[model samples]
Target: MSQGRMASGNDSSVTEFIVLGLTQQPELQLPLFFVFLGIYVVTVVGNIGLLILIGLNSHLHTPMYYFLFNLFFIDDCYSSVITPKMLMSFAKQIISYAEHMAQLYFFSFFVIDECCILTSMAYDRYVAICMPLLYKVTMSKQDCLILLVGAYEMGFVGAMAHTICMLKLIFCDGNIINYYMCDISPLLQLSCTSTYSNELVVFIVVGINVVVPSLTIAISYTLILSDILCIRSTVSRSKAFSTCSSHIIVVSLFFGSSAFMYLKPSPAGSLDQDKVFTVFYTIIGRMMNPFIYSLRNKDVQIALRL
Candidate 1:
């Protein structure tokens, strides 16, 4: 709420930032805390359970499930990075610049990793459904590992880019962050210096992260749908659709919420609304992924039972 003074030059006057949290109302604090606590609990339990199940079951060790394993891991970590600090925010926590930068780095890393992994999962589905004969050959252990490694590598590079750009900005005395965590948008709004370079980097990096993976997913599903349409058997068609339905649901939710948050122009007044959108991908979506995949996936259900 404070329109603090802008940075004079390259030097930063502010050493730390105050987090205003999701809401300033005294009444909503306890209720929101309990709600997010419940979300964090479910997110941890579900993702961890899925990770353990995949690790223990040999049948679930294929390319698809391998990707799912990493997905769950990232979701667990992603939720961890934001939710706990979010909980602390209800009590009004202050974070130093170094701490905020660390949060930004990890947050960016896991999100980009999720995008890449989801893209990989789409390709895995494409191969399995469109070229069943070569699924094994195409999605071998080495290939899966390469995809996983690439996702991590891309994540590191993207996170580094965002963090480094942020480091260049100078902050004046208006050190209050309106959101629950140290997100790039809110942090950019706090800078005393001109944020043109930072904003541009955000646009370019986010554009690539969102657009590239989205295109990959679209092409994969297009090919997949074409193959499915050619099949004559009703049961076969339904089976193929079922295999992809869960992924489709997840991709829609994750990409939709994330793109809304990062890709849009962050007018100074939109920070309040940003928190609402942030809740979807940061907490709710992560919590729902395991359920969405497990309920729709027979293998996961079977493994859970066993």
Candidate 2:
């Protein structure tokens, strides 16, 4: 029933947070930092290089790549949100309530953006393969722009809603976040106030974010597969199936990690493994996407050659 620190009369003492990242062990810090630094380096290069490739090649400006262009942007920004903080981690960060909220907000924004963008991309592929002749008509430049805009909008709305709900809860127990980032689950675990409502909202929204998009993706690929199976030529079927399998792998890599992160119960005992999965989702996921989706791709190969 109590308000957040802002409205609570007794919360004047709690001004900032001490964020505890991955590990507290002295020996592990340097090694993990360096290792994540390498992962982040690859993330930066891969996403930026893919972006440039998509931009420069006029032939690559089709609807699929168009969706990918946005996806790449989201991937880069998404990793940037969490990885650098992990890399530059100190013993404990002096994070204000506002800063804490901002970090969680932006993190949620980009994470949800990735979800929506992936769904949009799946829809793009569905239209491209299942309804080839209607692909251009269905996914025009305007429609593509609308989809991109909607993805951003969905992210913004979800972030704002979560942040607002978060601000309503009081956090007097401790200002230390056990996880690397100010994620909702870890933060909720730290709340002193009754978190029934907060947990409910988290469950509902996260269910929608993970489940609905996952189902959409499943249905899209199912239709695409059914359409692919109807093709008669062996070479054509093999090629289409290969591309489809690659897409499935890329999608699985992301969704699997994401579901593990957001869909699980709150941080309990040793969260070391959770932190590792968090790293995979926030740091490694983006780095892998470009390679999974396009590293060996013929179009990207051609573009790079040019």
TM-score of each: 0.95, 0.92
Stretches > 4 Å off in candidate 1: 1-12, 266-269
Candidate 2: residue 218 Cα off by (Å): 0.5
- Report residue 135 deviation for candidate 2 (angstroms): 1.1
RMSD of each: 2.6, 3.0
The residue-by-residue lDDT of candidate 2 on 76-177, one tens digit each, is: 888887877766565445667787788789988988888888888889888877887998899999999998898889888888888999888777776777
Q: How much is the lDDT of residue 247 in candidate 1? A: 99
Model 2 root-mean-square deviation = 3.0
True-structure lDDT of candidate 1: 0.90
Native-to-model Cα distance after best TM-score fit, residue 259 in candidate 1, in Å: 1.3
Error of 1 at 116 (Å): 0.1
Superposed by TM-score, candidate 1 places the C-alpha of residue 163 at a distance from the truth, in angstroms, of 0.5
- Model 2 — which ten-residue stretch has the worst lDDT? 1-10
Clash pairs of candidate 1? 7-192
Question: Per-residue lDDT of 1-306 in model 1, one digit per residue for the tens?
Answer: 233333444554666788989999989999999999999999999999989999999999899999999999999999999999999989856877788899999999999999999999999999999999999999999999999999999999999999999988777747888889989888888887888888888888888988889988999999999999999999999999999999999999989888888777753648888989888888899999999999999898898899
